[model samples]
Target: MTGELREAAEPTRSEGATYYGRPVIKEPVWKVPDVPAYLYLGGMAGAAALMAAGAGLTGRPGLARAGRVSSGIGATASVAFLVHDLGRPLRFLNMLRVFKPTSPLSVGSWVLAPFSALAGAGAVSAATGLLPRLGWLSSSAAAVLAPAMTTYTAVLLADTAVPAWHEPYRELPFVFAGSAVASAAGLGVVAAPAAQAGPARRMAVAGSALEVAATRRMQRRAGMVGEVFGQGRAGRLLRTAEALVVAGSVTALLARRSRIAAVASGLCLTGAGLATRFGIFEAGHASARDPRYTVEPQRLRSR
Candidate 1:
């Protein structure tokens, strides 16, 4: 999450009005560790839930067990990170007291609550063989809720005034969704038996391709505002992520014959997914530090 802030140079006379190099939007108070961890884990949990559902329907018991366990672990960890970010656990509980359609956090709180419970139930069933029927129902419910849980955070961030986040709102969900798929597939590849790992490897390849494409498109459409993604620590991390994703996807295609290759591919995709989350977080900070990103876009629109 390291990022070096490089302020924009003074605007030329031709460049519309300036605001004394001051930020128009307040920088996010969210810390690096908590929010990014929440993002990554939530994505992983959501995708894992989907994988669990798929494995159940297809009669792949080994993959289904792997998915259930991963979903539960990821969902639990994501909540811990979120509560840590809030500084007080009660703040998250309070968010669930009311439902506000206009508020992503409010909606997300509702989403996470049921999903977490269901994920936990699924895991318990897998572990203790208790309430098998209940576990099936819970896993089904979680699979239905997973997509919203995964993408709502992107909408939450995009709802903000942060220049980097808000500008590419349309693509952010896809970016998050693809990352989640890759992460879950990575876990599946590593944990499931080789015979049942075929679908996971294919998913890893597809998700990696989608993530890379969507991310590049987001940066391209963001214009100068996206410069944060191309410089400093953010840039380095993103480049590394892209490389890993590409390599992992290729290796996954060849993993059917080699256990070692499957492990290697899984590690690569997992690392890439985590790196993408951190890179995006660092890029947001970089965008906020530069006043030009805040003011220039509005100046153009008004003209």
Candidate 2:
């Protein structure tokens, strides 16, 4: 352990002690709003693309159209946020030069580029009523790529040195997948007609359940690093997300029968997704900013 935090940590080493009023590690340089927004939109768009593809193949044209449009917009916006974080569009393109399966950043860039193009093209064709076969094919391809898009962010975060993020790698992917599904479903419920929204409402309920379960399990398994999730700003946002999930899940059950219910459920689930992304981001930062979380977890693992 570093000298500055050694004394502070000694008194309560089991609990990771404290920061001793000084940061023990170099904080992440990722920007606010940009990174968090990218995370949120990437998940939403990925799941939306998957749902859209399924709808298209299953004869649910309205739902498919809505999903394609939402995915296209969300994916395009997600790329913008990611590019903004990189500080240059060319920097993002540079990452595409090598297909490094082991590098999350490189892999993510590759997955993102084609997924965005196909999803966007699918949306365009759906909207203009041109090339229906090609649009369906494009959406199907995007769907194949969507699972990676939704869960890859979790993998990316887990690869980081952040205590909270890296320690909970196994659970994070599940949480991300569920959140993505819920967000995509929320969009469908909001945009699709009631007759065409049945699948969406069901998806929302299922996804919300998975997200809530995986998140709770992750917290319990996170050990002391998990404490950050329930403290300060992170706590508030996560609690709010949980509340919203519960409310939204219940509301979704009533959605197919009532437009008002559908709208409310959609907003709540989407809002929960946004809040979860920000909250998880904050928790990772908090864990890194305080050295105890990092040092202690490593200490225990080394033993």
Number of the top lDDT candidate: 2
Q: Tens digit of lDDT per residue, candidate 2, span 121-166?
A: 9889888999989988888899999999999999999998888899
Off by over 4 Å in 2: 1-21
**Residue-level error in angstroms, candidate 1, position 246:** 1.2
Poorest stretch of ten by lDDT in candidate 2: 12-21
Residue 11 of model 1 has an lDDT of 52
Q: Against the correct fold, how does model 1 do in TM-score?
A: 0.93
Tell how far residue 139 is off in model 1, in angstroms.
Answer: 1.0
C-alpha positional error of residue 189 in candidate 2 after TM-score superposition, expressed in Å: 0.7
**Model 1 misplaced regions, further than 4 Å:** 1-18
- What lDDT does model 2 reach? 0.89
Q: What Cα-based lDDT does every candidate model obtain?
A: 0.87, 0.89
Query: What's the C-alpha lDDT at position 175 in model 2?
Result: 93
lDDT of 1 by residue, 126-188 (tens): 878899899889888999999997788888888888888888888888898888899899889
Candidate 1 collision pairs: none
